[model samples]
Structure formats: C-alpha cells, structure tokens
Target: MKFSRFAILYVSFSLAVALLALGLQHFLETVPVLSPHFWLLFAVIFLLTGLAYGLSDIGIRKGGQVSILSLMGGLFLKLLISLVVIAVLIIKFPENKLLTAINFFSLYFLFTLFEVICLLRNLRDQNQT
Candidate 1:
C-alpha cells in the first residue's frame, strides 16, 4: 500500500492544473471578443499534462529496468501523436479559435498515455529479461 512519488506528483500536478485552468477560465470570460474560456482551460491542461508526463517518463526510463532512451523518445512520439489527433479533429469538426480546446484535450490524453506506456513497457521488459 505504498504510493509512488511519481504518482503523487502526477496527482498533485493534475489538481493544480485544474485549479489554475478554472481561474484562467474566469479571466478569459472577462475579456472581450477574445474570450475563449473553454480553450483557455484546455490549453492549461495540455501544457501541465505534457510537463508531468514527460518528467515522469524520463525518470522511469532512466532506471526502470528498460532503455532510458526509449523513455525520452516517448515524449516526442507523444507530442507527435497529440498533434496528429488535433489535426484529425480539426478536419472532422471545423471550429474557430475554439479549436484549441480539442488540441488541449488531445495532447493531455496523449501525454498521459505515453507516460503510462513507458512505465508498462519498462515493467514488461524487466520481467522478460
């Protein structure tokens, strides 16, 4: 029943991002035509997600019984995957500046996935080897 430091950090970052995004959402709503609270909220989420996942991946890859370089590579792959998802979404549902919302969510999901996959792969490699 011991908790991992990475897990604690991830949860803390997620909550902090949520709170910050909520505050920013309020601020965005107060603006004029540039008011895009939804997009702003998502932008914060994506940025935080990338930071948390990338750092976590780096730590695990470096000594989790797997190749550390792969962990570093996962960050780029995750970014690419996020961009592709955003592109596909934009093509499927054309929106104005609000498109940032989709991009944010896509990146968040992709980054989180990359972190998880890296950890799992490391575990698998360790067990197999």
Candidate 2:
C-alpha cells in the first residue's frame, strides 16, 4: 500500500464514482449533476486528496517530528482548500447552492475516507518496521 499505488487507486476510484454518479443522474433527477461545472468538483477532490496523501506519505517516510507536522499541515491544507472552493461556489452559483453544497460535501467525505484509510495503512506499515 505504497503512497503511489494508493494515489492511483484514489484517482481510479474517484473516476469510477464520478461516472456512476453521472449515470445515476440520468435516471434519478436527485442524483446531483454538479451542473454548470459538471466534472470540476470531482477533479478537484481527487487531485487535492491525492496530493495531500502523497505529501503526507513522503513526510511519514522521512520519520520524526516531520511526520506529525506534515500530517496536520496536509489535513489543514485540504480543509482550507475545500472550504475555499465551496465558498467560491456558493458565491458564484447562488441559485444552485443546495445542490452545490451537497455535491462538495459528498466528495469531501469520500476523499477524506480514502485519505484516512491510506494514512492508516502507512501507520501500520511504520509500526511493523
């Protein structure tokens, strides 16, 4: 479960989820299209989460206080970016505010889950070695 492998997995999984959502949106109107900017939100979530996890993995591999600092910094950076993106969307698309918020939060939760799982795997590997 190296960081590189996990990153790739995250990207692939994100894409699959996006496709599934798109397909579902066709059948169920409530599925949330993320309209006006269809795939942008998905891309952002994947990229940001992958970047954060990859950087955290690098820091953890180095070992020491750096690991804790990088982990916290990565989490903070991710949260900041998500908030900023959501806020910008809110301002830009006032009419679709609810749909936009729901889409962003859903992606955030999914990516966060991916991040935590990868980090936990890193931690277990570190403990074993």
Candidate 3:
C-alpha cells in the first residue's frame, strides 16, 4: 500500500534523526535520557502520522467532495491524541516533566512537518489532475 512506503520512509527518517541526536548528545556528554524510550516514542509518532496521512490521501482519492475540512480534521485529531498521550506520560512521570515535554514537542513538530508536506503534495497532485 502507499502507506507502507510512506511508513518505511518516515521510520527511516525518524530513526536516523534520533540516532544522530543521541550520538551528538553522547559525544557532547549532555543528556542522559535519550534512551530506548525516546526512540520508541518518536517511532510510534512517525507511524501514526504516516497512517493518518495515508488515510487522508485515500479519502481524497476516493471521495470526490473531499475538502480542506478533511485535512484540518485529521490534523486536529492527531494533535488531540498526541497531546492526551503526552499528558498521561507526564502525569505518570512528573519528575521528568520538562524532558518529557521537550521530547514530545520535538517529535510532534517533526511528524507534523512530514504530515503537512505529504498533504500539500497530495493536494497539489490532485489539483494537477
């Protein structure tokens, strides 16, 4: 499926970024929490973003009347879900709230960037055809 290709690309990109961040952190001897948990969190975020984008693409391709509402709604839902998950994680680990929030925002921004780019590209293609 198209989502599978997108997922693979996103996963690779996310993983590479995470690795680079962790390596830099280690080399500079800064943060200590760039652990497996951080890696897994971003990986899941990437997957979720890709899945949402794929669904949006499918809807646009299938529904002749698809509108900007679809794009906005998808983004809203994804942001809501991500925020809720982050809230729960923060609540469960209050001691590391700052780090958790930073990591969450970083992942959120990265995924959002990818999501918006894909949506725009798809919209452009649709408009062309």
Candidate 4:
C-alpha cells in the first residue's frame, strides 16, 4: 500500500531536522551548554526521531506480520532510524561527537531492550493456537 502525504512529510521533516542536529551539536561547543539553541536543537532531534518512528508504525500498519516480527520490527526499525541519524552526525563531522551519541545510544538501548523483553514475556507461544 502507498503511504499518505503526511507520512512522506514526516520522513522528510525528520531527516532535515536530524541533519540540522548534527550541525547544532558542533555549534554547542562554543555556546553555553544550556543556551536556548542547545535545548531547541535537542527538542528538534527528539521530535524528529519520534516522527521517524511514527512513519515506521505507519508502514507496519500497511503491511502484515505475526508473532516475532511484529514484536521485533518496532524496536529494530526505530533503532535503525536512530542509528542512521547518529551515524550521519558522526560521518559529517567525526570526533567526540560520538561521545554524545554513545551516551544517548546506551540509554536508548537499555530502555528499548527492557521494553522488548517485557513485551515478549507477555506472550505465551506454547498455548497459542
């Protein structure tokens, strides 16, 4: 199935903001860490990442899957999107920028890991017909 225009817009907007976030991370080195720009850029990254996940969810809805795939796809796809965003940041300007990305990845990894385990635990494969 084809995606709606809003879905396309979400993908575009997320990529643009994610790209801008890499530049903003570099600029943060010279400005006050708590400056409006820092928080503003951070918020943009957060929103864009969320929109990317929303796009993923939309795609999943348009398709079909059962069992493991449905449970794993959401986590994996979001991680994939987040990783790409971070990778682009490092590739465009490689350095300790990886420091920030590393911390974020660790936190996200643990949280999503917890979520996936909890979701899987809720299902009983042996009893299902």
Candidate 5:
C-alpha cells in the first residue's frame, strides 16, 4: 500500500470502469439509462477516492488509533461529498433523476468497495509487519 502503488492501481481501476461505462452508454444510445453527466460523476468519485486513500495511507503510516480514525473519517467525508454532489445534480437536472441516481450510486459503491478492499489489505500487511 504505498501511495504510488495505490495510485497506479486506482487509476487502472478507474479507467476500466470508465471504459465499461462508455461501452454501456454506447450500447444504450437510444435509451437514457445513464445520465449525460456520467463522466462528471466518474471524475468526482475518482478524485474523492484517491484523496481518501492518500489521507488514510498517511494515517496508516503513523500507526496506532490514528489509522482507524483516518479510515473512518475518509469514508464519512467521501459519503457526504458524494451525497451533496448527487443531490445537486438531481435538483439541477430533474429530467433523468432516477437513472442518474442509479448510475451515480453504482459507481459510488464500486469505488467504495475497491477502496475498502485495498485498505483492508494494507491493514493486514501492517499487522504482519
């Protein structure tokens, strides 16, 4: 879980997701399943996840209870920011609220799961050392 390693892995994951989303959008061109602002959502989630990971990684290096607190704090901040972004998007563009929310949440969950998995692996490694 070095920051560099995490950055590489996260960027790769984000790119993969972006490609999948683009493909899906292309496939469903006639339908409006995904919002036009899908790329915006992707960028927001990607930056948030990276920022959270960096903060948590720094805390992990410091050790002790700080690590746990940092991880929790990062998760909370990410969730809060994501909610705000989604709410604004929904309110501002009320045309495809449901579809946009669904797409946004799916990306959010996927990114969150990836971060959690990486963080857990980092914690396990820290314990082993």
Candidate 6:
C-alpha cells in the first residue's frame, strides 16, 4: 500500500480507538480499569506502529529478504520500546501497574493486527504485479 493510503487508514484507526477508549473510560469512571496515563500510552503506541509500518513499507519496496528483515526488525524495536515504557510506567505508578500493562498490551495488539493486515495486502498486491 502507498504511504499516503497507510497514513490515512492508520490515523482513522487511531482516532476510532481513541474515541472508544474515551467512552470506555467515561463509562468506567468509578473503576480503575484504565490507567491514568491513557493518552500518553495511546500516543506512544500510535507513533510506534506508524514508524514500524513505514519501515516495513520501505523494505518491501526494496524487494527480496530485506522486506522480511525490516518487518521483523521493526516489530522487535516496537516491542523493546513498549517494554521500556511499561517498565517506567510501572515504576512511576505502582498503584495501577496491572491496569496500565493491560491497556498498553491491548493497544499494542490492536495496532499490530492492523499493521499485519495492511502489510499482507501490500504483499499481495506486489505479488500480483
């Protein structure tokens, strides 16, 4: 997929997720289901996913094994950065460690799924050509 197309789709998806998160947090205001730093987590995950997608797309355009390597590398870097963020959050906010971790992973998986689907579509298009 083109970078422009990916950016549009990704921004849309991020906005939808943000809206859903806002609704969920509002509905569960009394409960501590969501972390206090929800927006920070959202921004971090969003930027990481976009960066990874861009890296993978560039790799795909270059062809051959570079594509797979770049995809894997991007994912690995995302994971590492996410882990560091989680660790810092847990240390700084010990009261809501579990909630923060859960929310972080939830967003991580959701974005990863979207990234995979888009990449697969791109690969298919490349193969067809």
| Error in Å for residue 89 of model 3 | 0.8
**What are the per-residue Cα lDDT tens digits for candidate 1 across 40-116?**
44465456555645554555545654346555565666566555755665566565546455436643664476456
- Per-prediction TM-score: 0.50, 0.89, 0.81, 0.43, 0.96, 0.96
Per-residue lDDT tens digits of candidate 2, residues 64-105? 999998898888899899889888878987877877888788
What is the C-alpha lDDT profile of model 6 across 39-126, one tens digit per residue?
8988998999999999999999999999999989989998899889989989988987888989999999999999999999999999
| lDDT: the better of candidates 2 and 3 | 2
After TM-score superposition, the amount by which residue 121's alpha carbon in candidate 5 deviates from its true location, in angstroms, is: 0.9
Better of 1 and 3 by TM-score: 3
lDDT of 6 at 61: 94
lDDT for every model?
Answer: 0.55, 0.82, 0.72, 0.50, 0.91, 0.91
Q: Can you give the lDDT of residue 127 in candidate 5?
A: 90
Shift in Å, residue 95, candidate 1:
1.3
lDDT of 4 by residue, 11-122 (tens): 5654664566567657887753232233333454455445444444444444455544654565666667666766666676565564656545644554454444434333
lDDT of 4 at 61: 49
Error of 4 at 37 (Å): 11
Instruction: State the RMSD for candidate 2.
Output: 1.8
Q: At residue 10, what lDDT does model 3 achieve? A: 71
Which stretches of model 2 miss by more than 4 angstroms? 30-33
| Candidate 3 C-alpha lDDT tens digits along 30-121 | 55555335765676677668667866777777656565556766787788888887787777767767777777788889878877886777
Full-model lDDT, candidate 6: 0.91
